[model samples]
Target: MSKKPTLRDVSRVTGLSMWTVSRALGDLSGVSSDTRETVRQAAAELGYVPNRVAQELRKNTRRSVAVITASTSNYYYINMMKGIQRTLRPTGRTAVVADIAAEGVYTRELEDATVQDLIQSRAAGVIATLTLSLDSVELLEKWDIPVVFVDSDPPAEAAMVPAITMDNFAASVEVGAHLAGHGYRDWLFLAYPSRWSTRADRERGIRHASERFQANLEVIESENDVESAYATLSAHLDHGSLPRAIVAANNPMVHGALRVLHERSFAVPDQVALIGYDDFDWAPLLNPALTVLDQDSEDIGVQAAQILTRIIEDQIQSERNGRPPRPAYQPADRRRVEPRLIVRRSCGC
Candidate 1:
């Protein structure tokens, strides 16, 4: 059997010194631009893979960042992670995905276990996608590791934490406006529990907008999973009257509601209008295309990782310069993204 290619082989193939090859592959500054590309091309051709574990050991500091999220299978996190990996490339840091079961429910045991894993893995910082418990925040604070939340706002009690979020409430208002303008005054909002900060804010926005137009809007809660949401929506349709429009607070719920609508053989827009948050490619291809609120989830991820990286660098620079300990907390930083409303056949437009 052939042995796995090593850095030595890349050096030999590229006709560069071992030190030059090492620096180039590691993205260190000492290598020239031409030499770096030459070494990378050689390594690619030779099937050479760097031993990240060995590099971490030699560096004595974790060169990896942990992304704490829920529902890794969801498309939202998938696109966000793409941005994270892209931004992290130049930093020479690796991304480790840590999935938390049931992101909406913040548990102490789960927090402890997750924190332990990050400590054991020696993660330099954390990029979180859900609400964190106070204890979880404090533990990272004590360790002096930074955390940046993505797609959700930091809990009000969480001090000095930064978050990359969307203007879900304003977007919700737009959704309500379009639905109401069409003389569809009766509205139903399907959502998961309010434990998720994102859901709560989006609900708030929709509610505010609906009230302005005197629309009769009712919010219903369902389980976070698609199947559970499907069941809940199915039962609701059986006993109660269907509204003129249904606003699903998230993508999974939207899928569930759509499935129920399909099963009931209801004509979208003509019978009952449907709209949802978080657009995906399949949205346009549905029997009657779906009107969706499209936001840049990837940009959210990139911004969160960038904030954490800046914090980590600042800390390292301070230590090397023998400066006094930097404050563990600063004013909580916040950024919001605006979403574009896509008009399609589903909204009766």
Candidate 2:
């Protein structure tokens, strides 16, 4: 087979200097439109593909932002990614996901390794879905790689870092209040592990609401995936009677609870009612439409991306000005989005 074409081949074919070819291909300011088009047509004819790794190595900058997350199977990440990608598109940057919990489990070691990998690649910025360890946060900060948390908070020690999260406590309170409105005296909460920062607040709100409404509340923890959710809830149900209502903490938990109920031939909102966090496309399509607290995950993702982009740009400008390129995080960088409960058949609405 023939060897792959390179920039030198494009320069040779276009009868232009390598610098001009590089500028035209990169769409930098120096190249005129006519010459840029000529270089592009010749490169296309020659099947020349720019080597991004080499380009980054030469420029000493990264063009991709890393998104740190766990539980890649969760549907919430899908819309969140859509928002991140859409926001990054016009900026000429890309988003790369690094799933620390690819096996449906999260470990400190995995988180460390993922952060190390991002640092090695010189990621421009990070948007994390789980609170990273303080060590990881400090390491990224040391490298001048800013992190913006989305749907999660930064480690408490790193308070100045930016974050965009929904008011999970209030959201959970609404969930509990809605269930209480249906007079669901015995309530079950299917929750993901507290490794996710939002879990504590969500559980706190649920507990407060349960006390306020005088409901009997049971909280069960599961790994952040559908299968684990199914197994955990199934085992719980095997030992006890179903509660009057179930509140699933997120998409995976919701799926798991629904699967267990369906397999057992349980009629939703009849003998038992169900509600979930994070609305998705198929939530309304289910036989008994799922009532959910819509966190507007996409908007959160957009805000997180925008925040990271601004920080990265600021760092770049600082570097250009011959200053230390540290992330300039302000108190106002911490933001919260409100969640709205969508009533549907599943919640006995």
lDDT of 1 by residue, 83-103 (tens): 899988888887989877553
Q: Which tens-of-lDDT digit does each residue in 214-302 have in candidate 2?
A: 99999999999999999999999999989999999999999899999999999999989999999898999998999999988888888
In lDDT terms, how accurate is model 2? 0.88
* Candidate 2 lDDT for residue 1: 100
Residue 271 shift from truth in candidate 1, angstroms:
1.3
Worst 10 residues of 2 by lDDT: 53-62
Which number leads on lDDT?
2
Tell me the TM-score of model 2: 0.83
Q: How displaced is residue 132 in candidate 2, in Å?
A: 0.5
- Per-candidate TM-scores read 0.78, 0.83
Model 2, residue 57: distance off in Å is 3.4
Give lDDT: candidate 1, residue 25: 84
Ten-residue region with minimum lDDT total, candidate 1: 322-331
List runs of model 1 lying over 4 Å from the truth: 1-59, 102-108, 322-333
Can you list the residue pairs that collide in candidate 1? none
